[model samples]
Target: MPRLIWPLLAALLLGACASKPEESPERTEAAQYREAQSAMDANNYLTAIDRLKELEARFPYGRYAEQAQLDLIYAHFRSQEYPETVVAAQRFMRSYPAHPSLDYALYMRGLANFYMERSFFDSFMTTDKSARDLTSATDAFEDFERLVTRFPDSDYAPDARTRMVFIRNEMARHELHVARYYARRGAYIAAINRAQYVVQHYQRTPLVPEALAVMTAGYERLDQPELAAKSRRVLQENYPDSEYLDDDGQVDLAWWPREGKGLMSLLTFDLL
Candidate 1:
């Protein structure tokens, strides 16, 4: 009898505790946010975006408004709606400049730009990104640089640094490709300038050896054997067994940029 009475009392307390007050606006707003987050977790990004936008609109200055705005950015990003993601990320940055999650907003902003430029077309194009215009990639580089500079210790900084490395390499390769084009066209001086840009500005990239090789080739064409020899020495010293070098450690002219394969290389770079 005592056990039955205790069980009944516990049930009554649990039911009272589970009972809620009338649905308040704040309560509704919180519920909406939870639902949106659940949708995001389920990979229903479109649904998450819709719910988040509603939360932001209905509770403009509400407790969850700013959070909703931030969530909207991620939802859009996950959906591959890069432009919308940037808009929402920018809005989040502006709305909460000092928010603890500000690093994430900046990372997402940069990531949006990164994805905007990383189209499927890249996989099929020549290695030459020069003519297609990489405004988005450049913008992403700047954004990632800022994130690294400001939030060096943040969790996202590591990924931002990795992205920066890739962007730097691609940009360096862009300059080298232009240099190769000029070298192929008998524009030795222009080729030298572009190659020098790669050597000086992008010294850490794989293209540095190629840049040195271009410099050697360009100087040879310009009838500057002294400078050509100097470039050859530097190339040999730094990249002794560089793929751009032959068994004799001389520049392998055959390694020069291909004449008409920028698009093909662009598409096949990662695949191959």
Candidate 2:
């Protein structure tokens, strides 16, 4: 009731009235998600990624947290950050195995790995992708295979199937490339083993005939006449018109581009 006490009370009331109220957790989460979604709709993936990461951090157990994680994978992929895309996708899969979008996460992980070795300059270069190290391609193939096998009815299954085929072919071709490399270097046993890997694992691939040819040549060089005859017989039976076979039924490896130009370059992976 004192005059000085009344003034202090009035000041306190004014301060309380001017202070901002804290937003409810649910409302805050929803608003942040909306902002991220709007950025994505506008094709601002960088902004979306930032907002999505912040949402996940602030609302770790919030209702929109899982969805934010899922969007982070896609936004990283769209931004061409392949490694981050893979990490985000894999994290989502591990965090929410029972989520309805699990198939999407697997598919995106596969896609991210599939393009891991490629760069923007690849589009303008004529590099032989199959001849390069195919570790990422192999990983992508397994990811796609798992998706197709576990969620065959998922909307992503069809595309995963298609990518699986391409990866399989690339793997088979990579094995064949290694086989030819060993064969060219007169490492007969190594060449035969590599070629047989392709034959045993990639039965339906187009490169099977070439693998058989490598095996035949390698066996002949190793003085394994019976094995060479067996490989040649199989090639004749299954792929009589294969380009690797000459008119005399011999294994002709003259078609390799690197063989004609320089042996050192072929072995050094173009380091020359």
Candidate 3:
């Protein structure tokens, strides 16, 4: 009789263990977040995205929702799905403008645009110059500028500042390239306008010296000696050691600086 009672007790204990209560959605969401974070740390971006999305849907208004959204953005970024990342970041910014992660959201938005703009060079080399992606890049630059201005003490501000410089330089380079195309075809007036646009819009960019050089050369070729000399004086005053000079004491007609490497005298331009 004692042996039979022991067997029955063991069976009861096993049934009780199997009948334990299911975890609440909150607890499940927490578990998912932890697992997704582990996956992200392992660089398993796709898995992390899936898990994070599930968490978001399962706890839409819960405490983990915001973190899930932020992680989703990071996952898209890691996967190089920049458009998706941008969309997620924009949504986060709109939905949680006052959240403590607002600065990070803004920075991610800018970074997405920065990467999207990189493809512009490929488009520019094609015949469809109008298809270039400068609009997105311009928007990004503005967003980053806003972030830096509004959240100066944010941890992302320094990165935003650096990206702003890169954007300015790229914009200036694009303008300089267009100016050169016009100048080579004897469109000196058009070239001058474009070069001046670069000087006016992207004065702090590394390409400013090359843009000034183009203006000087364009003015000279158009037989506007006074304007040519004036442009040269501006270049010399602003960039005394510019490498854009030619052997004939004139600025090179078709030269532009490498994208990020400015002339040593760029700091003296007083544009910043």
Candidate 4:
């Protein structure tokens, strides 16, 4: 009787175990993706990243893999880990060049740079400890330009155009600032060249007014009074309300001045 009972119990346990349904691979993948989504919703970005990575590894060709990759990139960005965010975004672009989300990925890549750029004043003071990020910003702008040019109808195009404007203005401002530094130090030749670059290359930029003011000041410092007067006249004519001019029709101190003693005298003189 004991042997018969034991055999029956073993058979019953085996039947119960065998009757349990096996989870389909699709179901497992769905479960993982759901977990990742839940983590993300909770703002547990690190956990979500780990879960999504696992999902991709286990189901590379699954329905959720692409979304997992996209979310991973976003997670890195949300974590303020820009380098990782860039890496993930670039990977997405390379892997799925024609994906509908490619535009978004490209835009994010550029936005990362925009956030990384130093303020105009910081760069001006030469106190920009974040100068290294400018390289990233330039690369991001290039990516954004590519997207706008290649996918003009993309939803991101307008934003990309706006960002391009910002980047161009920033670059123009940077050049103008360097020109101002040179002029202040009596490096009139260098200042004039930089100012000319702004005028010629970035004529339509917001910084044009400032660039023209710098050119007027630079020409004055270089003893090119004729050129200086022409530049000032143009500035006053084109930008009548420009704050670049003082009440006496003179360039502000922020602009270069003509009346200082020659560079040699200023360097050699000892004021008592």
Candidate 5:
């Protein structure tokens, strides 16, 4: 029994010695970052995401951790996984509010929502979708505005500002589209409401002319000749060259009124 005990003890000691020591966490983190960078370079975003997440979870305490989280955002965005991009960007912003890379996080957050707001329906819908929900587009615009406000000197600011213009146009167009739809359906009051909203809230937008035109059309439909004339007066004053206006700079009563059928009217997008 004593001999057997000695052999068992020896075997246990040898097994312990043969087992590999735990690798240093710092080294592992560095390796993970390298791998992620390599994958990103190769455009293998999913692989980069896996390595970046692992690095972030294991080492949330230094520059490497911050880089990991930021890399995760780029990986998700490059992969066209927009929801994940938004989540990661928000998380980075929350965790590192004063991080030097905050501008990047904000820009990416806006970019994610920007893509989410884009859809084939918006581009090719038969009817204008002013009444359609524009929550995502509005959200993206806010994000961009915040980024521009907070980090005006950031390299991303110029692009963010440009995108803000696009978002503004989309929103204003949405309102004008709804107003036109309401006018077409003989819902003059609703048409006036939406058109008025665009003119008041979204001034300077390219859609302003369209909104004023809708207001004029709506008032005309409601048999309020005075109000209709007032709307036309505003439209002509602001947009003398507007296609919606006649040679006399009056709101064109001939165009939209001519199309009287089951088919929906289409609008050409002129956003910059």
Candidate 6:
């Protein structure tokens, strides 16, 4: 009887233990931050983004708000939600202009716009981006410039400067692309204007020689022989070995910008 009673008591204790609900881990700002960080470490950017947003919402004035906001921007970027990254970055900058991570926000904002210029398909292809609409590229350049200008000593300033060069060149190439298109269509005045913009705004780029060539062609087509001669002379002097210049140092009248119609063109009817 005693043995049976002991077994029953043990069973009852086991049942009681099983019936008690397990305590949930306390949710705190730090705990949420750690969860988000873990998600980020795992490259689960979507989950990280959700956790970060929740953290920010639940503890707007919490000590981790600023860091969480910055992390949110990065997570959005990694998740390929470029527009969200930009918006979050912009919001952070507005909210905390004096924050030490302002440079980081500026850098990420620039990166977001940079990626926004290229669609997901464009990222995988080797197609030329200079022929596409460069509004986002222009915005990105401005953002990087702002970062470099405001925080010259920042860790991101060097990279920003480097990206600035690439953006400037892309913009110049875009202008040259427009110029060549106009020249091909016999819009000489418009062609010369676009080429001139490249020369004025995008100095030190390889596209300058091509811009000069376009200007020369446009001026010749417009019957402005003197202007054409001036442009040709500048091209000959600055770029003696320019591809647009013949062995005789004269501008090649038949040269046109090479256009690429890649997979993107097939899918988008060349709109991109």
List per-prediction Cα lDDT, in the order shown: 0.85, 0.87, 0.82, 0.80, 0.83, 0.88
A best-first ranking of the candidates according to their lDDT comes to 6, 2, 1, 5, 3, 4
- lDDT per residue as tens, model 6, 1-272: 99899999999999999999999987999999999999999999999999999999899999999999999999999998999999999999999989999999999999999989786687668878878999998899999999989999999999999999999999898888787777655567898999999989887988999899988877777789999999999999899999999888878856543244468656865455
TM-score per model over all chains: 0.78, 0.81, 0.75, 0.77, 0.79, 0.85
Model 1 ranges with Cα > 4 A deviation:
1-27, 121-132, 255-272
lDDT tens digits, residue span 88-157, model 1: 8888888789999999999999999987966677657745555556788898999999999999999999
> What are the RMSDs of all candidates, in order?
11.3, 5.1, 10.5, 6.1, 6.4, 6.3
Query: In what order do the candidates fall by TM-score, top score first?
Result: 6, 2, 5, 1, 4, 3
Worst 10 residues of 5 by lDDT: 263-272
lDDT of 2 by residue, 1-272 (tens): 59899999999999998896966666488898999999999999999999998898898999998889989999999999999999999899888889989999999999999999886789698677778888899899999999999999999999999988888888998888787777666567888899899999999889899888888877777789999999999998899898888899887767333334477767786445
- Writing each residue's lDDT as its tens digit, candidate 4 over 1-272 gives 99899999999999999999997665589999999999999999999989999999999999987888899988988877777888898999999988989888888887776665555576457663322335766787898899898889999899999988877777777787778667766787898888889988888898787778887877776779999999888888888878887887776755354455676657764121
Off by over 4 Å in 6: 1-25, 256-272
Which residue runs of candidate 3 sit more than 4 Å off their true CA positions?
1-27, 119-132, 246-248, 254-272
Off by over 4 Å in 4: 1-27, 118-133, 255-272
lDDT of 4: 0.80
Model 2 TM-score on a 0 to 1 scale? 0.81
